[model samples]
Structures are given as C-alpha cells and as structure tokens.
Target: GESFDPRSSLYLYGNGDGPTSTATIDFAAATGTEYADEVENVSFRINDIDWGSGNHTDVVTVNAFDA
Candidate 1:
C-alpha cells in the first residue's frame, strides 16, 4: 500500500505506535527536492524489541528541502 507523494515532508505521520504505545517513530531533518532525496523507511523499536516480528511495515519519507 505504498503510494507516491510530491510533498511528503509537509505531511505528518501519527499513531505509529503499535499496541498501547509499544512502538514510536519520528521524522525530522528532511533534505529532498520534490520527494527525490527523501529519507524512506525510518526505523524504530517495538517495546525495545523488533517491530511486530517483521509483521509491521510502517515507514515515512522526508522531503523538507524544496524550492
């Protein structure tokens, strides 16, 4: 269910936490030109463990550097 975004950094992702705040993710410091040089698939931990044993696939993109 991955789609494309022209201005990804302008958008914010929430509720990345898994099951009662087991996991939390944050996106910052984007350096992309119209979604090209973006940071994809930022990593996080689930209750200090693996994210749902690879069952979860939550990712974010960084695209703050634009004209």
Candidate 2:
C-alpha cells in the first residue's frame, strides 16, 4: 500500500483566459510516503474556480513505469 499528497508538488500554468490551460505534477517533488509493488488503480480530482458558463472538457493522462 502507498499514498501521496500532490498538493504541494503539483504546479499549474498557462493562459487561463485562453482556450486551454495546463497542469503539471511532479511526483519526485511530492512530499509524502509511497510504496507499491504494482499500481492497481489511479484516481484524480480536479477543482475549478470561477468557471464561466460554457461547454468545457477535461483530459487527464498518467505515466507509470516498472521499478
């Protein structure tokens, strides 16, 4: 079992006023404990502020490697 809190390590940048925004997460910089033999599941929760009225879309990607 393993767990990490990405709040301190995650960085978000890019033009919010524009059509797109980008968020980058640095797992290496994260301040937490992690231990896992195999990744059985992954989850993400995104929060937005002052999102105006319009159709919006979200895309998420995760990269994993065997150690």
Candidate 3:
C-alpha cells in the first residue's frame, strides 16, 4: 500500500438557488490533529457552535476528479 497525506484542507461549500449557504471550518480549533490522503478513507466531525442549532451530521469522504 502507498501512503498519502494532505498538506492542507479545503473548505467544502454548497450553493442553492435562493441564497448562498456556506460552511465554516475551524481546523485550528480542532482539539487533535487531522490528516488526509489522496487515497484512503476519511472522516470529518463538526465541533463548531456557529454551524447551527440543528443536527449538522455529515459523512466525510473524498474522491479524485481528475487523472
């Protein structure tokens, strides 16, 4: 197997027809260290209070879009 790591993480954003909704990621506020790889399983957890009052549950996954 090969090892893969991410230098930095990018903010995932989503756009809607009515308004432009955004997600705030506080990687710095994370209690522990997080790492990513181009190939492998990944996961994400939201600990920020500013996200919302409702369940902000999510499934973390990454995929390669280009060769």
Candidate 4:
C-alpha cells in the first residue's frame, strides 16, 4: 500500500524480470535478539491499488474513535 514505509520494505533479488540489478538485505542482522513476546497494536491502510483483480486478501479492522 501507499502508506507502507519504504524503509520497512523487504527486497528479493534474482526474482527475474526486473528493471536492473536489484538491491539486497541481510535479514539476520536486521532482526536482532530473540523474541520477547512484545506485542504492539499499530494502524495501517491500503490505498491507490486496483482491487478489481481480487487476487490478494486481507482483513482490515479499524479502531473507532470519538472526537
């Protein structure tokens, strides 16, 4: 989605048929330490996409707030 941050993106090289030489990342170095069972709730949205294909699926749960 448009709101998904570029910094948090996962890149895969040699998927074949790309613009040019793709970049890579070291996942092990990225995820440091063992799981601490730390759970946090965050809000995200999907936008600017053509859902006409209906090829993917996801359940969106919105948090209602009164202002």
Candidate 1 clash pair list = none
For all predicted structures, in order, the TM-scores are 0.20, 0.29, 0.19, 0.23
RMSD of 4: 11.5
Q: List the residue pairs that clash in candidate 3.
A: none
Assess candidate 2 and give its lDDT: 0.49
Which segments of candidate 4 are over 4 A away from where they belong?
1-5, 10-35, 53-67
lDDT for 64 (candidate 3): 35
Q: TM-score winner among the candidates?
A: 2
Q: Residue-wise lDDT of candidate 2 within 1-67, one digit each (tens)?
A: 3455856345444444454665554334234647544444556644554444554444445565754
lDDT of each: 0.41, 0.49, 0.40, 0.38
Count the clashes in each prediction: 0, 0, 0, 0
How far is 13's C-alpha from truth in model 1 (Å)?
Answer: 9.5
Say which prediction, candidate 2 or candidate 4, comes out ahead on lDDT.
2
lDDT tens per residue, model 1, 1-67: 4454545433233454444332333444567535543466554222222345453545443343432
The candidate with the higher lDDT, 1 or 4, is 1
User: What number of backbone clashes does candidate 4 have, counting pairs of residues 3 or more apart or in separate chains?
Assistant: 0
